[model samples]
Target chain A: MTVVATDETGRATPVVSGYGPSFAEQQPPRNERRSPRRLPRGLRIALGAILPLLLLAAWQVATAFVPAYRLPSPASVVLAGVDLAQRGLLGVHVGISVQRVLLGFAIGAAVGLVLGALIGLSRWADVLLSPTISAFRAVPSLAWVPLIVLYIGLQENGKVAIIAIGALFPVFTTVAGALRHVDRHLVEAGRAFGLRGVSLLAQVQLPAVVPAVVSGLRLALAQSWLFLVAAELLGSSMGLGFLLTDSQYNGRLDRLFLTIILLAVFGKATDAVLGVGERALLKRWT
Target chain B: MTSTTALPVSFRGVGRAFGTARVLRDVDLDVAAGEIVAILGPSGCGKSTLLRSVSGLDAPSEGAVSIAGTAVGPVDQRCAVAFQEPRLLPWRSVEANVALGLPHGTAKEPGRRRVAELLELTGLADAARRRPREISGGMAQRASLARALAREPGVLVLDEPFGALDALTRLRMQDLLLDVHAAVPTTVILVTHDVDEALVLADHVVLLGTDGDLPGATVRRVVRVPGARPRDRGAPELVDLRAELLAGLGVPAHHTAPSTAQLSHQETA
Candidate 1:
């Protein structure tokens, strides 16, 4: 039978000769094609800045009409930040919170990954462990603070334990779910090729879920910050959370706003670092 | 690479069941060393189940499958399978995916050399560095075949390896499989639905279907195709066999010439 070739214009041309058009000849220059056009980086950044800039302007306008003790001006919040920095308290609070988050996140995520893999790969492990873990996950984050303090006794470990509890569930849930749903066909293929146990987990199952693991870690990081605030606000003497409570008690609204801003900035900064790693991982894995 | 002898495969009253439903039953067949055999059947006829039994990916509820005189174990190492979906690891480059099939404990250098050679054999050398998602379906299927060959398996199991490709690419892949068999001369057990594919490739084409009211499929008929490797697709003998195979598969042979129609009727009877 004669082959019919369709040109770009949608007209069919009959081919009477040898082989039909080669795959290379039929394919568009896909490598040279770029994704849909996007705004330039500088313009995109400027566009993103518009709302925050408008909020700052609105805040400045509000300070003129409202009482300074209630709603601090942006300049006064900056000045309060400077006051803390001058006294060396700002660095200590920020440093302490960051250290807590990083340590708790590392320990929690590592445990989550191990437990998640176990539950995911084994039916017996999942049956035995999942019910209890799910029930624990249902408990509110603040509910753990009292227990943590009672057990670990209001020390660095208590705060870290609280944060660790916050961080564990997201990583555990995502990793278990992702591993459970990893392509059965791929796993079967790997098995047919002589892979089993640890080799199968490393070579096939784990790599398949790298994207899920990264997203889970990002969620856990956010949870760590939330739990850190809960821990510090309840019992800690020095942290961003402590600064927030101390400022409110002393009628230092400016310092409270400064602490809130620092938390937002640091939370976003850590997430952004994770985002960079995610991009690299997706490039390599996906 | 030195010429490695292919292993013989034997099945004795093999059967498989998932819960209460039986998919295959009471089948017996023997494949000589270095021979090519095709299992052709209708959809849901347990063709893949039979092939999986050879690779030890699935065990028969009754009877046994032995390779080279040994009963097959779970995840048999002597056989390699190329499934219908290519099944290349999407995260890995084509070259790395092929290397994954190397026998366990193969030294790094020798494994690399074997993968490179199979890549060349499958005409995937150029796309070796590309991820499976970056390549076309046909190219990905070639990578799958290359990975299977990298095992240097005693029996190469292909479960509809080209069934997903377009018609033109399928025809090309058929020829490529022939070339691969010629190069390695390893025992190949190919499962496919296409009558032409089986006729063009296998030394013996085993037709699998239910016998009257049997609950599960077994070997219905074994048609030994009469031709050498790379047989002409449109040859009169192949066309006649194709009509007969289709008739056995329950398709009407009314469109064929009168004499072939009579032949198919008699064969089905």
Candidate 2:
């Protein structure tokens, strides 16, 4: 056990693998392989549609048990939708609401990305700004209506600002948190490959935070819709929110029910689209 | 077209501590150009810290480490490392992951060719577009090695690069590593707890330990592996050497004496 040897007598012999050589040339399996348990396209579509049809049946049955004026039947709601569409009001209101949400969301997400990067990358920015933003975040989005109207009047700018404000916090919190806690080994790998400063941040840190940031965007998108309703009720004359308020005020229960269903459908549709896009973007990582 | 001038790595009175717990203390070792040195020690012996110091991932608290006579910083571009975890970017394809190892400002054509060369060498050319989660552990590790080699470093540091693989995969990776080293000669410092791995791959083995009542881990013994790179796995000398290494790591070998018979039985598994 105590025998100490040196290279003086340990003559070098060229090392060769005991496995000899590649007996046959090996090839890696193709990258086009799909998941083994995938269901057929038609079956998948059928499976996805079953629950919604059941929910629609339940809604129709519930209308039979409730008062007609309070809870409109699905048939009556559809008739009201047809009436509004015949008058060309449905398209105008829905289009206006959709535009506001998209514009507000774009602005909010851009601001959040910049602010989150600053806070996440620099200690000084986090210490100086995070506390104040957190305090403001605690206030409900509706609470700012009076102040907003007072300063800016009941206009498109004020409504869009409300939606932006509602959407901002989630994106900011997630991006900063994700960047701060990225895997240490990944960072080390980046450094080993000679990445530093801005290149490291752009190539490694940003990509690592993408999954979390996207989830945050989804949450912000849903919040924007909620805020849009409140903002429109406070000030606007044309939007899905306006139709809901107008119908409720005039006791037009069928129109009210139609507007509510339309909002729900729009929200669900947008969420589904976002989910699909996210899956496509992160197919490799997930 | 990177130079293959094998860099000599030297540590002089090197020490490292986290707050107050000193891990490595007053260590001194030199690995010659193109030689493979394995750092072997028990769980708390700071073998990984020693490797990290050389790669500049972790700075030494005292003394200095130099490669080719140049002192290293916290991020040394002259050396590359492969870790126990493959640590591939989940967002990147295998080919892109390998390409990431190219130094900044490297022209596009050369980098692309180097990545393709590495993928071919590592047997990953066909799985080039596959993502990390889509591959097996062995494939991921092979990609990691390719990424490290894409840097064309003068020194390669591997911190238990095959520690996570199954036994069969580990054996294959060892053979693959030998083939890689032969094809592109570079100084290698491999850290491992397995005595067999150290003996099989290294030209010299450095056993780190706390000499009774010592404050931190230091080089307790430096054993020059007898024979060449592809030494017979069941050689009598290697069997004795394995037992010696186990004893050096404080494993009691009472029931199993170092012999050719024991080596064969161990290898069969």
Candidate 3:
């Protein structure tokens, strides 16, 4: 009887195609071969672009029915961006937003990692800190703004504090949860080999949670962007969020559309960069 | 590499209890320097707990375990263990994972050289750069063994290291283990359920079992197998010993011939 093997894609191929004892002699030596069903990279990317292009077309069509003051055409939005670029105001706004996001995300994520590790590794720390942290997390991001502005007085530091608060919880939650679930067998093995405390965490526990850590970082970054807008809208002299409010008050619908588009592009661009790093980390780890 | 000075390990009235449940009771055994001892027992007999005590991974509640006349500490530096599963770090390559077993504070150059030597000895030279997930089960186990040896440990603890491999691979691994022991000459404590494996590799086979109505298992028998390294598996003496061991384990003897009286009576009928 011939034996059959089914690959992950639900395709069955006979492992030994013929039913005789000499089937092994008849078969060629097995070697690495790529699956025929996979689409090419270029084709996959093109497939992904199709939906966005369709949405753009739909938006362009909708502009003809709506008044320009209410809903600017895509071409007019592009013109508004060109106008801002020529005046150099667009660069200043975009740069400031990017800077704020990076700074706040860095500080928040670093603190979150340390605190999360402490809470996850030590039962005493968990018992002491978890309740207070949960109460803080329950307060909304916007709720921090009034208190932050009162203390820091609408400066860059106040805006940064808001963004940092936004970025903190995701990293803290994921890192702590992930650490608790690292394979017990692996930890025991490491301990058996003379690993203890910090060395054990570095060699085994931390590396085992790379995938979760990366995902946490990604979530933290997205939150940074969200809180950046909140902080900027409240009290920024220059930023994409400021541009958003300024355009709305000035009734420049075209520039308002431009700001929204820029936000989308920048957010996706940052996430993509993180995605590349995540892939590299997961390759080395899991 | 210079030959490691194997340290003697001793257990005095060792017993273990988890909460109210006892697992081992009054277990006493002494391992000579550079000797191989196999602990064979049924499931739940605390064979693993006994080995873990030697490595200082688990402490016996009632008694002490000592290495070289010094009581074992919370995390004994004198011992290294290869568990039933490979338990290799998936993130690390085989070479790096093996390097992790090197004793703390080893110099960089020496550590690298030691890792290389173990990779070669374990027949993992080509797969040194490969991650744990890339290698086969037997290869992973060899890497685990190599990792344990990289410590140059006084006592190497193996808890069913070859139990997960196929029969052919298991035989090959047993031989590889012999080779490793010949090179390092460290004290080894092996826990296994396979009777044949115990007879093949150990100088002394220790059987652990519960006595009468005892709550916990203890040392039931210790048989010193005759002959030196690489003894004949099918020798008459070994075969007879195998039968006796099987009988002691409550296994009935197989393939015995009918008596002459029964055969003659059947023919007359």
| Strongest candidate by lDDT | 1
Give the DockQ ranking, best first.
Answer: 1, 2, 3
Q: Can you write out model 3's per-residue Cα lDDT over B233-263, one digit (the tens) per residue?
A: 6666666667666656656557363322121
Clashes of each: 0, 0, 0
Fraction of the native A-B contacts that model 1 recovers: 0.34
Q: Rank the candidates by TM-score, best first.
A: 1, 2, 3
The Cα error of candidate 3 at residue A148, in Å, is: 1.8
Instruction: Work out how many backbone clashes candidate 2 has.
Output: 0
Shift of residue B54 alpha carbon in model 3, Å: 0.3
**Two-way TM-score contest, 2 vs 3, winner:** 2
* Tens-digit lDDT string for candidate 2 (A101-166): 988888888888888888888899989998988888788767888898899876999888888887
Error of 2 at A136 (Å): 2.3
Candidate 2 lDDT, B1-269, residue by residue in tens: 56566799999999999988989999999999999999998887899999999999889999999998999877787889999888898889999999998867889998998898888778788778988766677777889999998888889999999887766567667777887887899999999988888888899999888776667899877889998776666667887888876777777555365343222111100
lDDT of 1 by residue, A105-168 (tens): 9989999998998899899999999999999889886797887788898789988888887888
* CAPRI class assigned to model 1: acceptable
Worst 10 residues of 1 chain B by lDDT: B260-269
Q: Over the stretch B143-250, how does candidate 1's per-residue lDDT look in tens digits?
A: 899898888899999999989777777777777777778767999999999998898889999988877666888988888999776676777787888888888787
lDDT of 2 at B52: 92
Off by over 4 Å in 1: A1-35, B258-269
